[model samples]
Target: MDVRFQTGSKRFNYRAAGILIEQDHVLLHKQVDDKYWALPGGRVKLGEQARDTVVREMKEELGYEVHVDHTPWIAENFFHYDGHDYHELGFYCTLISNQSYFQKGPYHGLEGERLIYQWIPINELNEIVVQPEFLTAGLRRVPEHTEHVIVEN
Candidate 1:
C-alpha cells in the first residue's frame, strides 16, 4: 500500500515525480478537476528505491520506458489541498527518453483516469499553478547536483 495517511489536521504522503523535458517544454499532468499541475509519477511503493519508482511510474502512466538520468531535486512539500493540509516527501528526478512513444496528444492515465499531458514551455512556468513552487521557478535547467528543498504552504 502507499505510505499515505490522514489525521485530524494533516495528510502525509511519500511520493516520487519525474521531470521530462522535450523541445524546450516540460511535460506536466493537468487533471481537469485539479487546481494545480502535477508531475508524471505516483506514490513510492514500499520496498522500492526512489529511482526505480520513477522508472516504474513512467511506464505505468505513459506506457513507455524512461531512463532516470539523475536526482535533480528532493523536496519536503507542505501545502493545502481542498480542505486538508498536506505534508509530502517528494523525489523529483530528471527522465531521459531513449525514443519517442509516438502517441498522439492527450494520453490516458494508467490509474483509471483519463488524464491530459500538457507540454508547457519553460518560459511560461508562471502561467499555471504548479505545486512545490521550487519547480516552476527552477525547472528550466535541472541542477547538476542533487539538492533538498522545502516548501511550506
Candidate 2:
C-alpha cells in the first residue's frame, strides 16, 4: 500500500516525485480543478525504493518509461490541505526518458482529464504557481549534491 497514514487530526505521507526537464521546459501536473501545479509523481508504495517509485509512477501516470537520473532533494513538507494538517516526506528525483511525445503540448494523463500534464518553460516558472515554493528557484539551479529541505506552509 502507499505510505500514508493519519493520526488524530494530522496525516503523514511519503511521496516520490520526478522532475523531467527537456528543451528548457519542465514537466508539471495537477488535478484539473486545482489551482497549483507540482512535479509528476505519487505516494511511494510500501517496500519500494524511491527511484523505483519514480520509474513506476511515470509509466503509470504518463505512459512513459523513465529512469531516475539522480536524486536532488529530500523534502520535509508541512501544510494544510482539504482540512487536514499534512506532514509529507518527499523524494525529488531528476528523470530522463526517451519518449518525445510529452514535448509536443499539454496533454491529459493516463487518468483522463482529471490530471493535466504540461511542459512549462523553465524561465516562465515565475508566472505560474508551483507548490512547495522552494522548487520555483530550486528547479532553476539543481544542486549537485542532495539537499535536505524543510518547507512549512
Whole-structure CA lDDT of model 2? 0.91
Residue-pair clashes per prediction, in order, are 0, 0
TM-score per prediction, in order, is: 0.90, 0.96
At residue 103, give the lDDT of candidate 1. 36
Question: Which lDDT tens digits does candidate 1 get at residues 27-69?
Answer: 8887778777878888988888888888998888777689899
- Candidate 2 versus the native: TM-score? 0.96
Candidate 2: lDDT of 147? 97
Residue pairs with clashing backbones, model 1 = none
Task: Give the alpha carbon lDDT tens digit for every residue of 53-90 in model 2.
Answer: 99998998878888998999999999998899999999
